[model samples]
Target: MGTLTTTGRARSVGALFAGVALLNTATVGLSTAATLIVAAGSGPGWSGLPSVANVLGTAAGALGAGLLLPVHGRRRVLSAGYAVAAAGALVAFAGALTTSLVPLLLGILLVGLGNGGAQLSRYLAADLYPEERRGRALSNVVWAGTVGALAGPALMAPAADVATGFGWPALSGPVAVAVLATAGAALAAAFLPRHVPVRQEVPVRAPARATGVARPLVAMVAAQLTMVAVMTMTPVQLENHGHGLDVVGWVLSAHLFGMFALAPLSGRIADRWGPRVTVNAGLGVLALSTATALAAPTAHTSGLPVALFLLGYGWNLVFVGGSAQLSRDLAPETRSRVQGTVDAVVWSASALAGLGSGQLFAGGGYALVAVVGGVLALLPLALLASRNGR
Candidate 1:
């Protein structure tokens, strides 16, 4: 594999970062708003439905992208996804206006679908660079989400104010923001360069068996499962403990910050130490974070925020590392299908976690959820250990 020219690389990376940032910003904002809406309209126990729908949408989008990218190419597929996301934003906003749970859920599901496609940016970036630099490329695109994640919730105040002035529901503001952001991302994607780097050329070597993808895929699934299981309920927990929406926003922002802010550093770590090591390290961090949250006496305590932040950070590390390892191990000719399948499975597991997280929290409490998550976090470690021993 050859290096991409500096200018070419920069242009491609910048475009990807911009598109990813916009979509992520919308997704995060929608996530917060959707949960609140569903909780108020339905019950706290059902809050996770929107997120579950979102992840399901993402899963569908990932699979669809896999099928489309090889035929229609990245730009067309990405732009279409954004367009669909924008439409979903409108649907969600309408749900807020009508105070109907159905529309809100439907809207979120569509947004999730769009987000699923946007998630492919990392894969695209990975393909654009040489193997040695693939981690950095992927992480850089992921890091772009830091901007969106932090700014997304901050926009809520103004959006709500505007919605109030317009006689619309408060939640409508954030969905509106999502619409504009996703539309902008769609426009940005439309201009992306179609020519991927020469490094993406499939090698002539005989491909390894598909079973080689299972290890990293499992790691990816475990990481996402634990992360979603905990994250989807954090806001509900805080609100239940008397914290206002503002505090929830801030806490979630912190968590999102952790998810994206240090992506570059994580990528570097993966490159330096190997993805397996990074994945293992992530699992440890997740376990510690969950235990900390479990140990906290109250939801209002400082431990919750700290735990959420570390949880997000741990998830980021594992996701990036596992993604790198998976990408590196697969043959380019079969990469798209394999990546799509693995992501679908991982996201499907996350979807299940999102669906069950609220019920778990309602039935048992955060401690029960955290303990279960901690146990799941350890599975990848055990698998990794077994693989190493073999």
Candidate 2:
């Protein structure tokens, strides 16, 4: 049979990849604002409000995982996620206006579902590409996501300014986010082929062996979990050092810069080195970042930011590795479902870390947080790095 190529397909898979950018913008941007506002407004600080965000985020993620199969197809699932996210944004915005925490939480929860599902954009890109180009193709799609991730938090300042000046609802940020998400989702729905998942939607044929695939999947999940855990705690760690909000914003941006700025190149690296080596290297960087955190002096305030940026580098590396590998392993028939399941596992673990981060910092202080995060970051890699064979 002839190889799969475009012509019958959409003009470019890249065009389809654009949907990921939109989803990332709404999900990441809204998340940034929601967490920040919650941090400021809630009584007990991260100890309380961020937990609400996590709870909502976790709930939404869980729901999305369950709904992925029954929702017609991947596009429909993604569209539904976007709509639910918009609803969440509206409710959250109204909550902020009315000073009702419940509504705000509900809004964030809706966005979280979209966030969870949208994350599978990488896998979608993988499905669109042939084996040879899959890694780079997945990277390009993830790179698109960075546009929104960077913009998301940056948008918050202007939005918060608007709320403060206009005497409108303090939740204007989500309102703006809702608009953007709605438009993007609609566009994605309209543009995406109604029938794209042709081979994908069918039932799967099992792979050669269970143990062979399980190790890599499990390793990738560990890498994902570690990346999220340390990454999540950075802001709180900085706050403990008396860093101001502006500093916090700058630090977060610096980390993103370290991460996505070189992501395209990281993808190239993974494609060349092969996924296993790339992922192992990623875990190494993460371990190094954690070690640095352990050594940072109590008098030094730079630990969190520096560590975050470096840890982000690890994430970039691992992201490229794992994404390509998952596509390689799974049956095309089961790709989206598998992607959803993998994300559910990764996000669910990270949610636990997110939920416990504040208490960890509070109880053990930044030092404990760093050490614990570091160990968790390194343990899985240590277990799997020997990785006898693919």
Candidate 3:
């Protein structure tokens, strides 16, 4: 395979960034809308259904992308993923109009399948660049989430108004946004080359003395599980304490900002200090953040935002570090397989977390949920320590 000029690499990366950003926009919008629709129809208790469904879909999508990327290349997989997500969005819209729970859950699940594929953008971005720059590349893709996370919720009101104007249910507006965003992402992905030879290069095997890939994979899964478990229930916790949707919105925005706003810095840290060190630091941060949240007597207190921000920041550190580490020292043939498997594990963990969070919170309150998350966050550190000792 011929080497791509710097210009070529830049263009490809730019296209990927755009596509991932758009895809995220759609997913975030869809998730928010799905929850609201479910809640309005069934009850507030069912709000977690959309999140659980989306995570399952994302796990499925990631597994498919990981399995297919090596054979089909990033371009086709990404395009197809966006198309699937868009189709799911349309189905969800129909469900909303008809006020049916089953179709909505099914549509949310389908959208998650596309989310799994879109998640590969980070891996592809890392693959596009040289080894030394992989952290930055991965971080750039992760950073794009900041845009969608911030905007998705804000669009709810406008989208709802637009839906009402069209004589449709207000919640249907978010589904419309999801359809448009995913479709736009697909259009952007269509411009990607059918084949990028750079991605097909042979792998560089890591030394046996080095930590095994399992360490990073475990780190990613642990981080994701912790993040999902705590984040999924935060809004409910706040509302239970008499906080309004506006407050929930502000806190979530803060959390998302923490998740993505510091990507470049986190990436740089991963590159300079090594993923092992970065991962350890992330674990510590998450442990502290969750513990802090657990100590809060009321969710409506000001301390909640601080704790959520730290939670997001810690998650970013671990995720960026783990992803960069995982991408190293693998043959092209195995890379996608490993990545897909890890994502599947991660999202599956998250799905379980999302599913159980509400029930757990109901039975024991947010404090117990935070305690579980904090303990999970510590597992990566323990695993890394054992690996190093060996």
Candidate 4:
């Protein structure tokens, strides 16, 4: 591949940022709407199914992207991913119109696959910059999600109203919004440069040394598992406590803000302090956030929002840090495949967490879920500590 000019790189990154922002909007809106649709129709016991399907779809998409990106190039792969997601959203809209669970789940699953592809855009961004600035570059894409943080849930009422006006299900409106947003993302992705400059390979010395990948991989999986488990149950928890959809939206907005608004800071931290320190700080914060959740009152409480926000930021730290670490020193040949495989594992684990959170909440309430999350956070911390001691 030819060397890309700085200006060209900047343009590509800008396109990716736009694409990511749109994808996040679609994802957030779909997730929120799907949860409510399922919960109302099938009861809260099955509310987590949407999330599980979404994450599993993401895992499949990511794995597919990883395998394809090396062969097809970034522009085509990413654009196609968004296109798939848009189609999935339309299917979900149909499901909402008919009040059908199977199609709804399938649609959400397809949306997740597209998300898996969209999420890999961060790696593409990293490819545009040198190692020294890779974290910041990658984070800029992650930060684009801040737009979705505000717009996704904020659009729910207006979108629903618009759908109802047309004699469609109110819940179908958000899925319609998702269809548009992902289509926009596909257009944005088409603007990405066809190729990125490949970095030099850093040789792996031994099997033991290659084990270094485990550190970041484990950190990411732990973070994803904890975040998904807690987040999947949060809306249900709030609703059970007599809070309304409006309240759930507000709390989710806050949490999404925490997840994306501070991405640049997380990137900077990963670049300057190294992934180890960043991951440690994230795990600590996660523990603290889960602890706060333990004390949330049955009635509406500011504490829930605070804890959820903390949970989000904590997840961001680990996610960015681990991503930065994982991107370092890989041969260009395997980069996309490695990233895709790692994300597949992370999202797959999160799917399980999503599935289990509902059951745990049903049996023991939110407290059990929170406690499990806190324990997950601590286990990674202990692993890091033991490694450092060695």
Candidate 5:
């Protein structure tokens, strides 16, 4: 019986890793295509709309998960989320076929909703592992996103070519890829165990205090806001400087690589030193990222890629560390609800950032967006310092 349970846990973790990878692949491809499509038809001012729709959908999805996960188990909820995202991708594909923004935005929103639910897979992974190893377990799932990071952008041009060959708009190709990828994620998630395995030992620790929850929530919001604001505008910035989709793809690949490649290292740091230390380090990196963006020339420069990579890594550190901190000492009964609620808040903040970034870029170029992101990044650090002083 013990051996059977152990095997089940392993299978579930493996499925989660695969599901995350596929979901990210779909997400990256859709994001890249959406920006280009919107910019071509609606102009630069509206390029950020796709990201706005996506994050808003994510926020709604996360909140819905908070309500549903407590009632249904992870397996059912996660599979459903991915399935819905697949349908949304198809809707976006149809929108692309017709060159209509309404269906495209609505589709991306559905995809984000699926993403919100799937993101909670990390918590399920943590639930299966012992407390001491929870960070590593969660990180492994994050690391799996490296596949999407590399593959999604790399496939963009080819996917576009395939779509163009079919006499369809190039944007439709990526959305087509999204359809396949999201469906694959749904299938992978279906393999998850209906119930998480019970931990053999429950470590004795004080219940999470308000400060414990608030601190992590602040870090997550800051990270998401800063990262989304900067990232959502980068491809548009590049295209305006005369770079093609190929260049945009490579740069985004570099950024996503930074986001996921060192996830395990961040997890180790969070586990060994502490989540607070990890978050502090992440915030410092975010500051540097903004500075790098500011220093880059107005035209295409190598500095943009470097800054984006730094931005992605910095976001990863905060996300992983904050997640660890939030999950610590959480009761099993309330774990899903708490995680879902926190993620909803984080993604909601990100939606606002995504919506505002295009306007900021339009008004003052990338500089204004970077400055706003930098300010947000530092605010959390200031709060942390004051707490320390107290």
Candidate 6:
């Protein structure tokens, strides 16, 4: 409405976008450990702490995110979430060193809290831009995280080895990674500019109307949860097929590369196709990919790579699709609260998937895990699609 060209606004908004995405490095560090730790043979009982971490972090994050609406504001909470989660990472590393499962779990739960709060980072892009430009901003934030996620595992191996050389378990990897990611928070608080002012031009919509606006947002969030739930856990599942780390890593990198590489384009797809179309199409593709991953659990042939690679590719589409939609779904009056609620729930759902995946995989093989998991995951997407982009 003012003198700012849309391009100029996006340029300014991109800084905040980078901050939010950079903070996603925490997810890379934490989730890498979250999924891999379960495969570490850290006693069956202890193997699940990472899952518990996901759940607990997300639950608290859901609540704590509400706090950002009023007191600290998004910038403060985003910055603080990174720093605080860094502490949790330290605690987790300490726990990993001592092999103290309870404390390890607690520390990760705190990471979950940090993650919960950090979920708002993507929303920041939504806050800074207008509805028309929202998709690109959201995609930019995600693409930033994609780079960090790729690096996270590479960094984890060295940190883990260092921890082992010091007569400690390798869990210190995530802790070290957490610290690295926390620096982003410091940068955010220092360099990220505030662009959105505190006033609204119209009377606020009721929760009912806001919720109506958020329907696609919620659907997209669900799509995101399903995507992360499977893609994040794929390496562990592949490892079960007796695939070596080399094989798993190759496939995972391919998967991540597929997702990360396509993020910017995915946003363009959303921008052109309409958010609803993008979300639905992406989820549909994701549903097919998830089913393929479930059906073929290994890259024994290039087929496995092709299928799982497609899974990651499809996940990129849906996740970015959903994220872009959320960024544009609501008005400023409801921005903080609605965005917080959406992210908290999305992450909480992801946590549940990670936590439950372990039990599902342990009780059953990867095939059963795939079949059951695929069915469970399909429900949300099916419901979302049933509405046909409303």
Best by lDDT: 4
Candidate 6 structure, TM-score to reference: 0.83
The digit string of per-residue lDDT tens for model 5 on 1-390 reads: 012278898998899899889989999999879988998898888888999999988888887876687557677888889999999999998898998999999999999989987788777777777777877878888888898999999999999999999999887898899999999999998888776333323332322343367777888899999999999898988888888889888888888998998999989998888888888889989889988888893434488888888998999899888878766756665666677788888888898888889889889988899999999999999888666511
Candidate 6 lDDT by residue in tens digits, 257-309: 66666777878888888766666666566667667766666655665566555
Off by over 4 Å in 5: 1-4, 196-211, 297-301, 388-390
lDDT of 4: 0.85
Instruction: Provide the lDDT at 209 for model 6.
Output: 60
Which pairs clash (backbone N, Cα, C closer than 3 Å) in model 4? none
State every prediction's TM-score relative to the real structure: 0.93, 0.84, 0.90, 0.94, 0.94, 0.83
Question: Candidates sorted by lDDT, descending order?
Answer: 4, 5, 1, 3, 2, 6
Show model 3 residue runs off by greater than 4 Å. Answer: 43-45, 196-211, 242-244, 297-301
Clashes of each: 0, 1, 3, 0, 0, 2
RMSD of each: 3.0, 3.8, 3.2, 2.6, 3.5, 3.7
lDDT of 6: 0.61
The global C-alpha lDDT for each of the candidates, from Candidate 1 onward, is 0.81, 0.62, 0.79, 0.85, 0.84, 0.61
Q: Give the clashing residue pairs of candidate 6, or none.
A: 57-112, 57-113
Where does the lowest 10-residue lDDT sum fall in candidate 3? 203-212
Q: Tens digits of per-residue lDDT for model 3 on 164-207?
A: 99999887887889888888988888887667433545553332
Measured with C-alpha atoms, the lDDT of residue 179 in candidate 4 is 90
Q: Rank the candidates by TM-score, best first.
A: 4, 5, 1, 3, 2, 6
Candidate 2, backbone clash total = 1
Clashing pairs in 5: none
Clash count in backbone of candidate 6? 2
Candidate 1, 1-390: lDDT as tens digits: 224577866776787888889988898888888888888878888989988988998998888876677667776788888889888888887888887888887888888778877787788889887888888889998899898878887887688789889999887788888888988888888776664322234433321247457667777788898999888888888878887767877877878888999999999998888888888889988888789889882655488878888988999989889888866777777676667767877888898889889899889987878988888898779778777611
